[model samples]
Target: KERFISLTIKKKQQDVVRFLEANKIEFEEVDITMSEEQRQWMYKNIPPEKKPAQGNPLPPQIFNGNQYCGDYDSFFESKESNTVLSFLGLKPRLASNVVLQLLGQVTVVQ
Candidate 1:
């Protein structure tokens, strides 16, 4: 049972890392298993409502510069809804916006 849980955690962590890398988002992975201080920090930063009713919250917790984003399930939902950038507190790219400057005239696309 413990091994199964560990595997599940590992998979979730991998999924998050893969998505972040694919999107070219810079992130730092902290291994709570290696340091008690890091583990405590994670637990402390998580919002009270997000904490599990039982044991400590599992890994694969997402954050944007100390601001807690959410857990693995939240990340999956955001990905499904195409709101990952907003979920991570990132500004969306202006892909559809067009900017043109011609003859000292500026045009902005909204």
Candidate 2:
């Protein structure tokens, strides 16, 4: 799944971008303020219930491929749980480290 985020040039949007960059996450940003068509398209694709409670229905909307993954809060939650990698169809590096540690614990009898 490709990582995509819809956002305007707002402070909150910038914060999300910063967070992703700090975590070394790759993502494509669609600036809704720059493109009305994109803004409208985002609105049409994301259901009202899924939209933020602010009622503006504007950006910072995060998505994994075509699936809407909520705004910054949701993204943060996924990040905290280390599920964002899985959502992007990427192998979880942390899990792999854990697996390797487990393997290292096993000692074969001579």
User: All models: lDDT?
Assistant: 0.63, 0.47
Per-residue error (Å), model 2, residue 51 = 2.6
Write one digit per residue (lDDT tens) for candidate 2, span 6-108.
2222555566556556756554444455666766656666768886677655455555444555665665677789786554334644211100000001101
Residue-wise C-alpha lDDT for candidate 1, range 29-80, written one tens digit per residue: 4446766776777788789999999988777676665677787888889999
Question: What TM-score would candidate 1 get against the native?
Answer: 0.80
Q: What are the TM-scores, per candidate, against the unseen true structure?
A: 0.80, 0.56
Write down the TM-score for model 2: 0.56
User: Candidate 2: global Cα-lDDT?
Assistant: 0.47
Candidate 2's C-alpha runs over 4 A off are 1-9, 52-54, 87-90, 93-110
Cα error, residue 43 of model 2, in Å, equals 0.6
Q: Model 2: how far is 60 from its true place, Å?
A: 0.9
